[model samples]
Target: MATLNFKHLRYFWMVAKTGSIARAAEQLHLTPQSISGQLTEFSATLDVELFRRAGRNLELTEAGRRILSYAEEIFTIGDELLEVLRDQKVKKTLPFRVGIADNVSKLIAYRLVEPALKLGEQVRLVCREGRLASLLAELSIHRLDMIIADRQMPANLNVRGYSHLLGESGLSVFGTSGLAKELSGSFPALLDNAPFLLPGEDVAIRPKLIEWLETSNLRPRIVGEFDDSALMKAFGQAGAGLFVAPTAIVDHVCEQYKVSVIGRIDAVVEHLYAITTERRLTHPAIVAISKAAREDIFGVGKD
Candidate 1:
């Protein structure tokens, strides 16, 4: 009904994300009562209830959902404005929030992200790590500028954007020395009678791993089914079970744990890809960073 302030939009966005005024206030470092007051004022001005209580949880009504979409767009535009203003030599410093899949090792992800942070004094790089699906969802909603993910993300993944495959990289099975010693020969044979720390059934890699196990006539004694590779490695390091991970991650795990590379699987090479919206592709910073990443960082030539 009236021109809204940026703070109101920000508060609204936070509440939409957190689903609770109290939690949103905590995140924004404002009082819950203040947030409630602002929301009340906003609702009155707009002549609509932005949110309603569904028991203890705050549920967004239709009006609230519509307004939230506009808020997201406004925030994106605001960020573009800041980027343009900064490009004019004002030296605005805002971190570029980059997301990566959890399948990537922490060490590898950090290595890739750290160099990108050194691009400019004002170019702060914020890394958000999660599974491929979650990272892509965040990217679609403009919560992330770009994401490093597997190439398996389909063209019809509702991305409504462009994605570039970085390159193919090898991933392999690895386990601690204690676990490795238990294996008779190659990985296929080791599956039987071994305590296995495996990815969850829903994971993309699960079917392939299952097929591989079946071909070897090996049925692993399942110890855990994890979605988190780091946690899998932790369990493996503690001698709970053997973990199968990417070869790129093997060296790092070996150094940290008593792990060894028992065997390598080159056929199942996982690909790295960079994904971004068409609009964001034109942003100077985005263009520069993507170019640098392709030409130097994770570049095929470099690899």
Candidate 2:
């Protein structure tokens, strides 16, 4: 029997986590050819076929699944051992890595995560903004400490992650002062035939907002659709159209975007979630974010 190759095992682990050799190679800072060769060598050493193609993705064979389970344990323990060692270093800066899902409001994200910087310790805050599925991939590979998302982990996703509800916020409609002034009649009635800027179809709030509009029987002409909530707010600031934003950070939005709230829609709520690999949050930054979101931002934790 030959001695085990820890490097090969690590490569396999990364590929399994990312579900692509190219992605794993990118993370490892190695060439795809190099990793491909190494993977071949690793499989030959073990004398087993580890992967088979399933559509565009690489599916682990039964043997590969067994190997991956062992690899996960090995690498996870190795990472913890390194973390324990790193913690002993005095005044060492802790890396606080977070991913913000694209659908989440930037204003709310900033407020929820800002408390981590004031933890009175040396902490480096790094944030990556992307789609929820992409952020979940990063979370599964341990590249991100946690994900700040508008939704929870999808049940169909194979990644093992837990979602902690930060809190929910009802929505508010905002428009420029001139636009708000021009609107006639009362509340929902005023919104009919009004110009509107809506979140993109891919966004979690888009469907809910549509349903609310349908239920209320108000159909504002959608002047524009934006994937970036911040960008949508910018258009709203310019009097392009009225837009909806979470009421939790409505004050910040109104101030920053220089818009006036036309009305509040308590029926449509945006549920915020913190998605992480661990069920019980252990990271100080994550803990701080969850606490601040519930108590300060969403006003749920307070008595």
Candidate 3:
């Protein structure tokens, strides 16, 4: 009903998106009191009740929800406009937020993202690790620029996203030096009754690993199951059990974790994908990652 102050609208939008003014303040780099003052003024200017408190969180009122819809659209369009005008010459660093699925090896994720940093100082990389479904939810809401996952987007998800195959690599079984030496006998046959650390059922490679083990007629004793690949590797490094990792990072893993390769699982490959909302990649940082992954990073299985 009155002339809009977009600055106030932006504060409100951030608060609404984040669910609390304090959290929004943290993201916007402002004090909570200052944001609260701005929000009070904003509500006064509009002569509408914007929020209602619900426990520790702020619940949007009917008017607030309506306003948020417009605010999100406004900011999204504003973002698109800025993207179109963005240039390397511009001093402002563009934020590229990526979500890495927890099951993905940290070594592989770092390699996939390292190329983006080497491109230039113009990109600000922000990384978050979580489950693929959670990351997909964030992507659907535009909270994440992209997600790194071991597989393609599920066909059942209602969220719209494009899966870009960055690269794929076969896996390798690894164990501590002493453990590997002890188990060194005859390939898959040596795996029989060997202490094995398996990926959790939620992981894409878990079933593949089970199938491989069964087909090879090797029944390794399950030492533990882990949802976090890095943690699983740590267990393997400590001689807790043998674990599997992407062969593309075999050397890196051996050096970092002080482990030795027991064998290679070339039949079961792990595919990496960059899942984004756009079918065509427009983000320069992401483009660099894709190029590097396909050309240099996972170009060949290290095994």
Candidate 4:
């Protein structure tokens, strides 16, 4: 196979960014034919088609999107290098990329990651939110430095990673003022036959919640289900139904969404984990996050 060509890669990146060979040619001060030939050679070298024609426009293929992500990082680093060499006082900012599971409470996620930004070192924090499986895939490829999730990495997954328990928080149910008034009963009894919003089955808490409801013999009317915790809270805030959040962030959730707490369920606990490629946490940002979560946020040591 031919070695990678930075020149061809640069041309391909420009074409991808401009969405047209002609536009890229104009920007690079080159002929359209020259840009087209470079892209063709680049694609052939990579053994993948980067773009597909869509009407009069070009759309990136899956392979193209993946390559574009790398290209963006490459060009960003190149620009930073130039700045550092050109200016003696300039300091390079360390990039800390974290993947957050969608089902994790947004407030809890923010609190867990907030400490990393406060660290003395200048850092560029990039947070990507998605499903656990998808985020784990990104982490496996070294695209993400760490992943924050409700559950630990599954044993069945082939990815090699260590799960560090951040801390656990009991569940707290909340509802709009009207709903709270309407369902005025003591504790779990108030939840019986009450309209409820809940996390989808894909969320780690869903199964535990279901089991708890069944054990309590409380059959709440299921009004809505959500894969995203934020969306579930939004619906709950609008008086759609009652929803549960981690007690660790109950105050913030209530303040932000203007919801009232219906009750707390200590039995239905939520556990948070930080999954990283390293068995022992060593990264400065990661260490700061772990320390803050245990000492401040959750107020408990690792499990």
Q: Which structure among the candidates has the greatest TM-score?
A: 4
Local distance difference test, candidate 2: 0.89
Show model 4 residue runs off by greater than 4 Å: 301-303
Query: By how many angstroms RMSD does model 4 differ from the true structure?
Result: 1.7
C-alpha lDDT score of every prediction, in listed order: 0.72, 0.89, 0.89, 0.92
Better of 3 and 4 by lDDT: 4
Cα lDDT tens digits, model 1, 1-303, are 387777877888899989999999999999999999988887887788899998887999988987896787678668877877778755655557788776655655555555556665567566778777777787788878878665556666787556766555556766777767767856667668888888875445667777777876888898899877677888988878876776655666688777777667666565566677763476545666566556654455563
Clashes of each: 1, 0, 0, 0
Q: Which candidate wins on lDDT?
A: 4
lDDT tens readout by residue for model 2, 174-279 = 9999998899998878999999999997688889889989988999999999988889999999999999999998889989999988999998889989999989
Badly placed stretches (over 4 Å) of model 3 are: 1-90, 300-303
TM-score for model 2?
Answer: 0.72
Ranking by TM-score: 4, 3, 2, 1
Ranking by lDDT: 4, 3, 2, 1
Candidate with the larger TM-score of 2 and 3: 3
TM-score of model 4 (CA atoms): 0.96
Quote the positional error of residue 36 for candidate 4 in Å: 0.9
lDDT of 4: 0.92
